[model samples]
Target: MSKYTTIAIFGLIAISAILYTYFFYFKIEERLPIYQPSQINPALVDPSLIAEKDHRISDFNLYNQLGDTVSLSDLEGKILIVDFFFTRCATICPILTSNLKLIHDRLPDGVHILSHSVTPVADSVSVLAAYAEKYHADPSKWWFLTGSKDEVYRLARTSYFACLDEGDGGYQDFIHTENVVLVDPSGRLRGFYDGTKEKEISQLYLDLATLKKELSKIN
Candidate 1:
């Protein structure tokens, strides 16, 4: 082969290598098989049997970072990632939220992030606003939310399947899991993820992409 032909062949091989790296190996973590109703330890997911029966939590009043009450109904048709966190947290919250931002930045305009403050008493609207600004959260696409402590706790347990305990609002004040719950446009619980786990976080983002593709089939 001539030198020119060899170079052209090399260029094609290089392009293929780049695509492979971006898609299969380095870009997103490999997704593990999530426990579906058909293949789960029935006891843990039993209550969730009503999962398909129960509609997504659609209507509720919560304060946005701006101190204004906002309703989930206001965001009905968006692909939402709901996560529970606190401003005062010295550990997982920051890391989890940072990873969440990674997920948020990758999504298209129609997708959104709904972050709920676990320590609602301490993380008032103003405080949440500060946190949002500190993280440079996009107000249009991301909402830092707060509401009644009891209601927040209830939502954490029933909605995200996260933990929320009662206390004096200090260390061990709130009990909640570290997972990003993905919800569909019609408000179905699609996937739950370990928000702070780097591998899982990446997989969750890609799963959102897959979820969107599945959603498109219905339309």
Candidate 2:
């Protein structure tokens, strides 16, 4: 082949390699899905929101373990790992809390945990505070929240889509599930995992790493 022709071929090959690397990196690093209400099980979603698109976690005002009021705005620009549990539980809650504690301890900056109390009435700030302490949960990185039962239930059903059962958030109603949800900084639901499963937690870590890469690109 002529020298100029050989040089042109090499240039094209180099360009092809660079393009392959760029696309491969981006393919693996693409952001997780922004889960919509329509994408979730209808039973777990409020009927009013079943057809809604672009759904985000609704605003909330709950007291944390430290008795500080925490709202959705307070968590803006944060990647949130969220779950629902009550202070007093004998079965899966303890296991879920333990796993979440592991996540909380290892979370990087701009990531936080929001553990909402299913039984907000029984899980007052004092109760949540003790629970938080039992787990050595850092107040800055992990927040055990308790507030109006109605609001918490609403968020569980409509926003996070964390459980399978239906409830009105009434005095007689109750919800219990092991689902852990991940929310991106833009307030979109990105993932759901079984909090009691080790395999699921491992997957969560992998997804979180991917999400961090996406966030890094945006920032």
Candidate 3:
């Protein structure tokens, strides 16, 4: 072969290797969908907030299992995962907690998990403390929150859009859902998953990693 022809063939081979590495080993990242208030179930959002494009998790105050107060302010500028459960739950709650534990174990810095007690009356600070211990949860990363039943339920339905059940946080109000909600660093709802399912929880982990990569770009 001619010298020039050999050089051209070598150049094409080098370009092919670079493209393969860029597309496979160094995969291009993607951003998770930012869920708008109107896109969520109508029952969970107020008519006014529905049309608002920048709806976020509203401010809230609840004490963690360790008796430390946790609020929206605490989670500001952090990626957060939230789920609703009661300590006494006998069915899917355990599975949800287990899956959450896996996610927490694999989490990177600046990520937090909040498990709010749906039965705040029964799941007091002391009860939550024991539950946290049972799960071997890292208090710094995972928080089991408990507060007035009304406050917890209101935040679940209105702010988190975490449950399909409707309630005014009244005496008879109760919520039960298998969903685990994801909130971005900006406090916008980003994704939802079935906490009780292993496959869905796996997807949550991947989405969380994607979110972290997206945030890293700005920092």
- For model 1, the superposed segments whose C-alpha errors exceed 4 Å read 1-55, 164-173
Model 1: colliding residue pairs: 163-175, 163-176
Error of 2 at 219 (Å): 1.7
Q: For candidate 2, lDDT tens digit of each residue in 101-211?
A: 778878888899999999998898998989999999999999999989999898888789998647689998898999999999888899999999988988888888999
Q: What's the CA RMSD for each of the models? A: 8.7, 3.2, 3.6
Off by over 4 Å in 2: 1-28
| Model 1 C-alpha lDDT versus the unseen true structure | 0.74
Best-first order by TM-score? 2, 3, 1
Instruction: Give candidate 3 regions above 4 Å deviation.
Output: 1-29
> 1-219, model 3: which lDDT tens digit per residue?
999999999999999999998999888668888988788878767676778878777788999999998788887788999999999999989999999999988778899999999999899999999999998999889999999888888778777888764668888788888999999878888998999999999999999888888999888
**Per-residue alpha-carbon lDDT of candidate 1 for residues 1-219, written as tens digits (9 for 90 to 100):** 999999999999999999998887666543333333434323324354434555455467888987777887788778888888889898999999999888767767578899988878788888998999988888888999888876676666555554432343344556656878777777766787888898988888788878777667667
lDDT per model vs. reference: 0.74, 0.89, 0.89
TM-score of each: 0.73, 0.88, 0.85
Query: Which candidate leads in TM-score?
Result: 2
